[model samples]
Target chain A: MQQTNRLRPFFENITFDRDDNELVLNFGPQHPSAHGQLRLMLHLQQEQVVKAHPDIGYLHRGIEKMAENMIYNEFMPTTDRTDYIAASSNNYGFALAVERLIDVKVPRRAKVIRMMLLEINRLISHLFWLATTALDIGAMTVFLYAFREREYLLDLIEDYCGARLTHSAIRIGGVPLDIPDSFLIDLKRFLDNMPQNLKDYEDLIDQNRIWKMRMENVGIIPTQMALSWGCTGPMLRASGVQWDIRKEEPYELYDEVEFDVPYSDKCDNYARYKIYMAEMRESTKILYQTIDMYKECVEKNETALMAHAPQYISAPKLDLMTQNYSLMQHFVLVTQGMRPPVGEVYAATESPKGELGYYINSQGDAYPYRLKMRAPSFWHTGVLTDLLPGSYIPDVVSIIGTTNIVFGEVDR
Target chain B: MRRYSPKDNVQKKPYYTDRYYVAPQVPKLDVESDEEFASDLAAIESKFTVSESYIQLDQLVVYIDIADNLGVLELLRDERAYTQLSELSAIDWLAKDGKFEIFYQLLSMSRRKRIRIKAYIDEAQPVKSVQSLWRSADWSEREMYDMFGIKLINHPFPKRILMPDDWEGFPLRKSYPLQGDEAASWYEVDKIFGKEHRETIGAELRDCAKVDRYDTERFSRLGFEVPKGADISGGEKRKKVQYQEDGGVFLIDRFDEEKTVIIRDKDR
Candidate 1:
C-alpha cells in the first residue's frame, strides 16, 4: 500500500485501461460553488463524474453540545444562528419543541403571529436560495431583484422584532411579543406588491433558454430516490411527493392559515424552481390572510395578546416607588427563562428548504438535554454524492446551489 | 390583503390508524441506556406510526451499539433502503455521565423517510469507523474526531474540518475549558453594542475594571455583600487584569485601555 501510494501519481501517465478511466479531483474546501466550506472529491471519466463524495463538517459549531449545557429557555437564542438565513424558522422549531415538551398550547394570537413570521421567513429563505442559485447559473440581475424584495421583507422583520437576519422572535410558549400595527401595515404593503416582483423574477429567468438548460434535468432526484434519501420541502415536492410538515402536522396557526403546497411532476431543477415560486405566491396569500387576521384581532379587542394569558407565576407587585407592574412582568419574563417538562418532543416545520425538525429533550430544567436540528440543507446536501456522479463539473455548482444547502444549518 | 386558496390543489388525506412505517414506538425505551437496545429496536419497527410505510414519507434512523456501528451502517447502506448518505455527525455529552453519542443522519430517498443512526462510545475508546458505506463520512467523522476527540478507527483521511490542523484541542467538547483565547474575547465584547465584535472585547475589560464609587444601598439591591471601597467596575477590571496575567490575555487591552503611569520630575 505504501509503495502504491508513492507511485500512484507516476502511474497516472501509464493507464492500463484507457477506455474506462477514473480521475480523482478535489472540488472544494475553498471553491465558491460548494456553497460554503464543503469539499467534494469527484471521481470522473472525462466530463462525466463517476462518483462524487462529499466531505462536510466545515461549518460544524457543536450547537447540539452547547444546547445540552444551556437552559431550555437560554437555548432559544442559540437557535437563531442555526440556519441564520431563515433564523426565525429555526427559533420557532426550537421553541415549539420546548413548548411541546411542556405540553403548553400557544395562544391564538401568538399562533397567528408565529405563522405569519414563519411564512414570511420561508419566502425570504427561498428568495435567497433562488437568487443565489440563479446567479450561480449565470443570471446576475436576479440577485438585485431578489434582494430588493428580500430587503423589504427583512425591513418588515426588523421593524417587528427589532432585528434582521437572525431574529430570535420566538419564545417557548409564544412569540417574544405582539407585532405592532405599523409593522403589520408595512408587511401588508410588501405582500401587496410581491406578485409583480415575482413576475419580474419569472420574466428575467423562468423561460430563458440558458436558465432552463442549466436547471432543467440537472440534479434530478426522482420521487423514489427523494423519499429514500429523506428529502423534504421543495426538494421532495420537486420529486412529486406531496408531503409537507405544515400541512401534515399543522403546527402553530398553519391549520388556520390558507395556502397551497406546490409540487411538481418534473422532478428536476426546473421543478424545484417552479415549486419555490409557487410557494412564494402561496406565502403571499398566507401573509394577506395573516394581515387580515391581525386586523380583526386588533379591532375586536383593546387587549394585548398576552393580556389574558396565564402567567407562569404572578409578577411582583407594582414597584414600591412606581406603579409599573406591566414593566415588572415583562422584566421577569425576560430575565428568568421559561420552564419546560422533563420529556422529549420532535417538532417539524415545512421550511422553504424542507422538513426542518427540532427535537428537544427537557430534563425539566431551564435548558434542554438534547437539541437536534433536522436541517433541510443537510438532507439536500447529502444527496449530492449520489447526484453529482454522471454529471459534468460545472453542473456541480448547479446541483449544490439548487439543493440550497445552507452550511450554517449543515455544519451545525 | 387577499387570502389565496388553490382550488386545483389536491390535498392528500392523512390516515388515522396507519402504523406501517411510523416512528418506532417501543414504549418510550430508556433513551439513556443501551441495554437490550436491539430488542427495543425490533419493538420500535413493529410499532411504527403508519400502516403502509411505502406510501409515507419518513426518515428512518436506527441507533446501534458503538461496537456494532460500522456493521449496521454497512447493512443499511448496502442491504437496506439507505442509498443516499446525507450527513454524519457527533454530539458531545460532556455534562452527562453516560456514553458520548455519535449520530449519523441518513436518508433513503427511495423510501422517503429519514433515520438517525446512533451509537454510544465510551470516553476510553471513542473510535468507530463507518467511512466504507459512505465516503462522505470521512471528513465529518474526522471533524467529530477533531472536536470531541472521538477517533475514527479506519477512516481513510480523517482530519480537522473546521479548525486549523494545528489547533491545540477540540473546541466543541463541554469538558474542554471555555477558557481559550477565543472565549476571552467572546466574554468581553458580547455585552456592549448589543452585539459581539472585536471592539467589544476591550470594552468589556474596561467596563469590568472601570472604577465606580461603591454605593452600599445599590449593592444591597443587587443581592451582594458590599466589599469595602471596592467599585464594581474596579472588580471587573481586576478580574480582567488577573485573567490577562494568566497567559490568557485578550491582547486588546494594551491598545484599547489607558495605562496608569506615575510621572516624577527628572530634577527631583
Candidate 2:
C-alpha cells in the first residue's frame, strides 16, 4: 500500500502512515534513561528498531543569540549555563576565544591556576558520566560510589568560586581570584584518596558479568563512522583515534603538563566506559602536577591570579578600592567592555566531553558580532540517528547512555 | 614589577616569552602548506575559487566562493582527507554587506591539522548543503537554518530543530530582538487545552490563583511593592466560572493565616 498525503475535508491532519506490525515509540523528552530531555522517535519492527529520529531542542535557550546582545565580560556567566556539568571548562573556553581575539597574554601563575580548575572540572564531569551511565546499565553501586567522590570535588570548587555547579571562575585575561590557601590543602587531600575511590568504583562494575554483557559488544561504531560523524572525546578515542586537543593544540599550560590520551580499538560501550575511567586517573595525575607547580608559585611569592593588562583586563578588587587609576579602569571595563580586533578566531579547549570551541567574529565592538559555540555533544547527538537503527529497543538505552549526550550543550 | 603597555611589542612580554609558551607546530599534511591544499582543490575543478588564505592563531582559514562550496568541500574531504566536519555555523553580517557568512570547520585526523572554510551568501540566497559528505552536517545545517534563516539547499530534513516549527523569524540574526518579539504572544496556554477540557482543569487553577492573590495583598501590606508586569490579579480575568464545592483540603489558607500569625508573633 502506498502512503498518501491526501487532505481531508473535515478531519485534523494525520501525521503517520498506518502500517501493520510497526510500532512508533517516543523514547524521551521526559524519560529518566533518556538523560536530560532528549526525545527520540523510534520506529520499531517488533523489538528491533527500524529507524530512530532524534528530536532535540527541548532545552534550547538561544545562548548564541544572548551572546551577541551582552558585553564581553557580561557573557561569561552565561557560558556557565551552556555545559552546566563542567561549567569551568565552558568558562575557560569562552575566555580563551576572547583572549585570542584581543591578543592578550595571561600571567604564568594565572595559566597554572586555570589549568588546575580545568582538570578538576574534568574529574567532576567524568564522574557524573560514570555514575549516570553505570546506573543506566543496572550497576547501582557504581553510581553511589562515583557521586561520593564527585561531592568532594564539588566542595573544593565551591570553596574557590562560591558556586558548586556553575563556577564561572575564569576571567578573560586570567582567573577571577587567587586560589584560597585552604584550597591547596583540601585538593591535596582529595588527590591522596582519589585512587582508592576509583578502585572502589572499579571493584563494583569492572569485573561484573552483567555489566560486561550489557556494555561489551553493544552499540559498536567503527573508526571511520565515528570520524565521519564528528565524534570527539572518548567516543572518538574509543574507536582508536588518538586525537586530543590538549596534546595536539596545547592551549594554556597543557603543553607543560604530562598526561596520556587513552584510546581503545573495541569501539563499543565497554571501550567508552573504560576510556572515561582511564581519563579520570590521568586527570588525577594532572591535578597532582598542578598542585606541585602551585606550591612553587606560592614559595616564589608570585601573583597567580589576574593578568596585569589594565587597559583590557579588569583590575583586582583590592587594587580598584585603593588606587584611583585602577578604579577608573574597572568602571570602564565593567560598563563599556574591551573591544577586540576586527577579525575572527576559533579557540578550542579539550573539555571534559570533547573539544569545546568558541568561534568569535569581532567587529571591534564591546559585544561580538557573532559567537558560535561548537559543542562536542552537538555532533555526538547528530550521530545517534545513524547509530540506533540496527540495535534492539533495550540496547537503545545503553547506546544513549554511552554517548553521554547532555541536552544543555546539544540544545544550546 | 613592570607595567605593560599595549604599544610595546607583544614578543617583549614575559608571558609571551616564557619557555612554556611554545607555539605547537601545525602538523605536516600531505600538502606542504595551505597554498598546496588550495591549488589541489582548484585542480579538481576550475569553478573552485580559492581566495586569500591566512593563519590565525596557528589555524589555517581559506575563503571559497559560495557557489562552489560543495565541490571544494568534497575535494578537501575525499582527496585531502579532512574527514571530520567539526563545526558548521553561520555569522549574520547585517550591518556590513547584508550577507551571512557560513563557516565549515574541518579537521584532518591523519595530518592533525584544522582548516576553516568560509563562504559568504546573501540573506536570501541558499548555500548548497554538505550533508551528503559529512553526516554531522545534518544538525549543524539545521541549526543554521533555524538560527539565521539561511536555507541549506538539498538538506535532508530542513525543519526547525531548536525553535518551534511555527517560529516567525530567526532569533540569531542581528535584527532580531534579544528579549524576543511579538511571536512570543502566540503561545496561549489556554488554547493548548481545548475550551471544554480547560474548564475541567480551570477550577484547580483558580484555587492556586486565589492563594497567589492573597499573597500579593500580604506582600503589599508588608511594604513590598508588586513588580511591574507581574500578574498580581493571578489570572482572574482568564478564569472561567468557579466550581463551588471546596475539597476542604486546607484548614486555613496559608497566605491568610500567615498574616495573622506574623502580627500575633510580633505582639508576643
Candidate 1, residue B25: Cα displacement in angstroms equals 19
User: Each prediction's DockQ?
Assistant: 0.07, 0.25
TM-score of each: 0.67, 0.82
Cα lDDT of model 2 by residue, A99-122, tens digit: 877777888889889998999999
Off by over 4 Å in 2: A1-19, B1-47, B188-268
CA lDDT, every model vs. true structure = 0.68, 0.81
> What range of 10 consecutive residues in model 2 chain A has the weakest lDDT sum?
A8-17
Docking category for candidate 1? incorrect
> What C-alpha lDDT, on a 0 to 100 scale, does residue A348 get in candidate 2?
80
The best candidate by lDDT is: 2
lDDT of 1 by residue, A155-234 (tens): 88988889998898887667757787688778878887899999999999988998888888888887766755567788
For each candidate, give the TM-score of chain B. Answer: 0.48, 0.59
User: How far is B169's C-alpha from truth in model 1 (Å)?
Assistant: 5.4
- lDDT tens digits by residue: candidate 2, B1-268: 8984542111111221234533332222333356655554456446566665666665767778888889888988888778889898988776567788889998887877778888788879998989999888888889999998988789989999988887888888766666565454333334476446754434222112234444543334233355543565543233322223355336432223224433557656
Give lDDT tens digits, candidate 1, residues B74-166.
666665556655456565554465457677766544544455666667765756676666545654566567767777677776777556565
Assess the local accuracy of residue B42 in candidate 2 as a C-alpha lDDT between 0 and 100.
55
